[model samples]
Target: MSIVTGSLFALALAASPATPAPPKPATTTLAPGVTLLRGEFVPGRQPDGNTIVVDAPQGLIVFDTGRHAEHAQAVLDLAKARGKPIAAIVNSHWHLDHVGGNVKLRAAFPEAKVYATGAIDAALGGFLASYRRQLAQAIDMAASDPKKQDGYRAELALIDAGERLQPTERIAASGPRDIAGRRVELQVVAPAVTGGDLTLFDTVTRTLFAGDLVTLPAPLFDTACPARWSAALAALDASDFKRLVPGHGAPMPHEQLSQYRRAFDGLLACAASKRAAAECTAGWIADAGALIPDAEQAFARTLVDYYVGNVLRGDASRLEANCAAPNDLH
Candidate 1:
């Protein structure tokens, strides 16, 4: 399926109470000094494609964990390669992908400390509440449709298998600190993508581990306030990072991040214009043919799908809204 179709399907699944449980976490190396670790509970893909790893001199640090325990084990393997124990595990946010490996990481590296923006802890708390509500409602939806009901049963099974991961710690974004032997600075910029979203900067490498704050094909509004997201991107634009890493997609220079920001702003403007003209469609996919061009069709459609089915519909708003810095969400 197309990225747009896939995203749309994910939305439908997320709301149906029968969405397949995510896969056990896994690991994959991204680039030198970077690893994309998977989470434990996410299904095949989407929403649960978390990337966790350590950086240079940053010693043992984690970016994010996939949705399952196995993914955490994958991280342990990577850490083992370093020939040293993990010093810290930082959750990008409260999302299952980013935080799923928390418990396992703690188990593997008993001495490692977990850190995250206070906002992430808050975000997780809200997600759990909302997720429970969504499941309850999804149960009813599934009951009405046999196919959906079967899926719901599968989800129930996954949950019963202890697939979901929740945060049990709290951390503060206490600015810059000495990670391993490296001196780095942490900044909680703006919550464009998610409420408590932020990034870490390595002054030495001039690299910024931007969470979901800077995404490719434009920032995913799957869980965002467009206007607020716009402001957040602008804030990022005003920042000083050169190299950047995103929660999804590969890493690139700041210019690439800018392109995403522009695309996001442009789309929001289009949405706002449509809203002002009183010609807005009831669905995100309705206007893709006209507003999104083919050259960048995949991304445009992805944005449309995420905005319409996820953001506009208020699917994960409260989770994003209540996230804070120095909070534990894994």
Candidate 2:
């Protein structure tokens, strides 16, 4: 998941660049004052995480901007339409799809502060740096594919983007922090989904933004340690939030989150057992039953199969690559 082409969702967006244009990000009202700019997961374009905009007393607080320009623009558009200033930007993780719009948003709101974990610093030098080199080699080898070249270049541009992409404020530990005149809980669950991941809890709405920790259809394990990630999910389940917003998919009630946890735990268990990978995949597809809508069941199946074969049961250290050491995987 460190690389752009990491997951099936990533491949769904990156594998080919000649598909139909993706529709603009859709804006939805998750609650009274919380608005969600749902990131587009269209066939041919890079996917973006759902951006949440909160109406703070001072200005708007944006959580997790999308990967593409148009998606970020939708966030900007939402702010403009409301006639408010963006006071703060909260990034859930270091993923380009989540933080790519930092510069774009900061350009418009120079005073806005970006808050996130410090994981991106090391990631830039290691994971993302490796990704940059891979893109360059792929672009060179794709001389005959102009459209593919364009797609690569677009992602490359984000890599070389402005310093605004870096966070101005660090969320080092789980605590209540005052952001844009609103108090929210920011949890630093590292070595779970990435080197650093932030899950925001809005005390006002009693809603927890679980980031990619609870992504629907199938959980992404590209940059995750299965054991550590399972613990992180436990932490979320223990939190006193009524509703949860995942990085992808719709906001769900606590019961639905429990379902996701069940599926994720089951997937890990199956992967650890001696059963066939197909059984593991089938377990995931079945465990994630209602979470994977009929329209997305096919996609969920494909992703789960890949996870079983290449990730969950693949290499010993692969899951702990982002962790500090393998001794403390759990």
Candidate 3:
């Protein structure tokens, strides 16, 4: 089987027999000629862990390292074990979970060029500045609530310990780049997922690395503009890709992505309609948890929180007020 297909097989085997299943041998073939090393990060499974290392001809290219130097080391080890040299590292966005290992990766592969979109560069700038601001706040709050004081100190420590990921040094032009025998095409689908989210496409294997662009359990729109994100999902449907490697959850069929988009669009529409009628937060929304299947009700609550906290409060609302009607196309 091809490496891509093989990789899928390995993942499937690993996923099967959830309880007491014997560990499958560490097989590197995830597909034909392509190798995917599932890193320690799987979103929803863990808040701060999600990274994947890919082995291609050009060397090792990782998609989104977790939130610390140690995570990067783990990825490097897996790559080294497979006889793959660290070549380049890329982030799907600037979220701390995605880019936390930028400093470490650069240190490990100094020759490897880090790539991100202009928007991500700007976003990183904002992130660093925000970190600084948080530090200041932490310092100011040190004398307040004891719990708050501890939180502030921890936050500051994180900022100080993390390497400053400068954009110009670590960023790249937003487009396709050939890496280790694989044609990696990076496309910015929309502002959903995150302000300048991008997905990597492997033309050779027809695989698309959808960086948090599509997630399970109804996905997360708290950090992005839902309207734009919904639009982004629509665009992804039109784009060509056979296998999708999501930033979170298991690798999914293309249709699952579309299904997720439609669900989010539906939730947003319901939220907006209520808001327009001045009854946005009525009892129905309060009971939203009961409407969806128990499997998805939790994520649905997150959507409701966004509607209330962001849209209603006008705190970080990015999508204006309209929730476009959902369509069968997603």
Candidate 4:
């Protein structure tokens, strides 16, 4: 399968029965100064990413704004409840699920400066343009069904009007940065999750905000470089962070991270050996152990298909090349 074929498959998947949108985001306190805004990414639904908020001495710092306006509002409410103004917003990657609420959040807190890896600009301009077109077609198909019309219309409006906020501070490289009186180490892992993947470590809380670099149940292999992604996971496993917050799942401990890494490694090895998609998927299923519950079997299979067809079968060099150059996906 090529990139074009993978993209078409993705669009076809999107046009299928709409997955249910997540309810209000739930909050989890990771540490004294760290709070996680957990969101859901149902395989076929309105997938929104997770957000992490840190209450520093100067003000509040947010990691990723989530996919929906309501999700972003939930984060804003949490910040208000903490009685700290949002001083900065750090986007982990260019995916809409991670950075969709950036514009609204920035409008709410004008003082908050947005930060992201510079490569996100190209993703927003290229890959996302194609994504928007596919999403519009999906919405149009859904609109014909009275039962799904309302939901599809709402999503369409969001796609048409939602602003893609540009990063005020483009991180050209990874290094230590001070935000709101707290020291943060930003690591830019390229051609992994996307062109520019920004992972953050909060020295104060000992937590790692791993964007799409690490996900539970199964990884979203869309627009990923398998080799680089595996390496990134290995680096995360070796890190000193006490807890890891993934882009779309619950916060994980080191043990869970290990499980994910093993599964990912198995899948990659199977693919690299010129195995069939079914073989790779089966290998991952075995390596994943009990992570895939009976109810989530369908979701797991979808992700596996995506990984094998999109990430594995596609040309690795082409994927890497497109990361630097603007994708003509549209």
Candidate 5:
């Protein structure tokens, strides 16, 4: 398969498994009124995106629902514990891990209005189509083992029944929005993570809910526009928020965010020189230093290669390709 599809396939294989019972997400209170629900970082299972819950005076506001049913349940449990009804739900981007629990959250809080950028339609369409194809492949591969087959089938049923929820309140521009008596600044940074990325900055808590715009450990460049992503990161660097909540991983401080931005800038410069993918990958791995540990060096190299070959090159055909043979670039 092409580099983009292959990269996604690899990530899917690493994250998506039909575990009989998924573990609970770890929740951390970032501030007095803000809480972060972090997804488990296991190798195989329904991986979850981080969910942020904001307790507003009128009610509760949630950002980015986790991927699995259990993950969503964890967010619900937090809301129940806080004794506040969900007033609004905000989707940072359209990725499945970020938006997968939309249906469940909406079901629980029917009156909760959803707010997101208008870019979700295209993202949702692409994901559902790709996921269906991948699920079929997984089902075929599991045919030899009845237990595995049943697991795949169960996952397929959830996919078929899952509903992708669109934003009831579309965020067309960046500015201050008053939701449930809470003031939030919605910053639109598109073609960075996805075409519909919306970064929320809480005026009260000074917390920046940066979707996939600022990932820890390693950034996912699968659907990124290198230049635009870099520009988005630069903008985030200029923001006044004190605490940063990424789409995945734990909440970090400004210093850590700056560190990630520097690495990203260096990688972009390396790719811009039109160097060999391997050469660029090595340079990035070297520049990243301890940011990428020795154990994850191989994976980091593969990601760098994908960024250079697909993202910087502007060659997205790989994302739509259906090659029978794996690229094995990793």
Candidate 6:
């Protein structure tokens, strides 16, 4: 419930059903032992980042757990069906959509150690703290309406569950790691998505988990440092990953990743130019082309416009603030 819980809750609640039942997120077996809990982004609501479950030698390793209850349930369901306990968790970043289900999953798998960057510690007292206040106000306003109050309260509950969201095991560097007997390469990038992002690369499958560095419906700039983000993409481009798993949308190929990088660079360049915000949005949609489906094009444009005006061009302050110090994840 702790989605992008600021004005989005108010916006989503105005139109969303009392208890919306989103369709089941698509789950695909990307490789011999890798399963994807694909994230869902409703046109009018907050989105859930994708989750990757690896059948590691030690046990099931869950990569980003999704936002809502059902999304998290999908992950748990996969674990149950596999007849294996969850032995570890690898979060992409600290965004609620990506890590909100940490508490739930941890409860289910009491011994599962979470592997992520140390960024969430600061977010507890910074960005998420500010958002907590927003949710509280929204909750107060909706107190007169039971349905609306329920939605806002649910989001607040996750924010208030502070320590539960922090990583149990901090990923402080970028390199090859043998987790639960599974040898996987880990990529840590900062001031890009959240304060830090923990991406996973499994040579066994030639798959790179790009986290928020690559997303659909356009690049979401909620906590991104545009310049650093470009460098992050460049790093991904430099890699020889055959299959790339993004934090959102479907898994893509190396060529698709290259296409995404070009569009990302062009979007940033366009935003930095003297062109109007509309021009930047249009260029993003056009540049993204096939990566974004026809149904998602409108939303993609909205996201581009939001990032351009608010993050890229709105103020020097946002850029400076978002350029948070990188975590000691070398």
lDDT for each of the candidates? 0.54, 0.81, 0.54, 0.75, 0.73, 0.82
- Find the number of clashing residue pairs for candidate 6: 1
Model 3 lDDT vs. the true structure? Answer: 0.54
The true-structure Cα RMSD of candidate 3 reads 11.1
Ranking by TM-score: 6, 2, 4, 5, 3, 1
lDDT by residue (tens digit), candidate 5, 1-330: 323333544554555344455678887889999988886544344457889999997899999897778888998898899889988899987666787788888889899988987666654355555666777888798676665566556545545644446788888778999987899999886557666589999999899999888764467776665567788888998888898988866687887787778888887787777677787777777665665556667766666676677666556553233211212111
Q: Which sequence of candidate numbers ranks them by lDDT, best first? A: 6, 2, 4, 5, 3, 1
Question: Which candidate wins on lDDT?
Answer: 6
Q: Please provide, for model 3 over 146-217, each residue's C-alpha lDDT reduced to its tens digit, 9 standing for 90 to 100.
A: 544443454345455444443333333346778656687877644555556667887777877777776543
Q: What is the lDDT, from 0 to 100, of the residue 93 in candidate 5?
A: 78
In terms of TM-score, which candidate is stronger, 3 or 5? Answer: 5
Give stretches of model 6 more than 4 Å off.
Answer: 1-19, 327-330
In candidate 5, how many Å is residue 262 off?
A: 1.2
TM-score of 3: 0.68
**Pairs clashing in candidate 4?**
none
Ten-residue region with minimum lDDT total, candidate 2? 321-330
Locate the minimum summed-lDDT window of 10 residues in model 1: 1-10
Given candidate 5, what's the lDDT at residue 177? 95
Report each candidate's C-alpha RMSD, comma-separated, in the order given: 7.1, 2.9, 11.1, 3.7, 6.0, 2.8
Q: Which stretches in model 1 have alpha-carbon errors above 4 Å?
A: 1-32, 36-46, 49-52, 55-58, 136-174, 275-303, 313-330
**Mind giving the per-residue lDDT tens digits that candidate 1 earns over 15-50?**
544345455444555556656653322222335435
Q: How much is 75 displaced in model 3, in angstroms?
A: 0.6
True-vs-predicted CA distance for residue 159, candidate 5, Å: 5.5
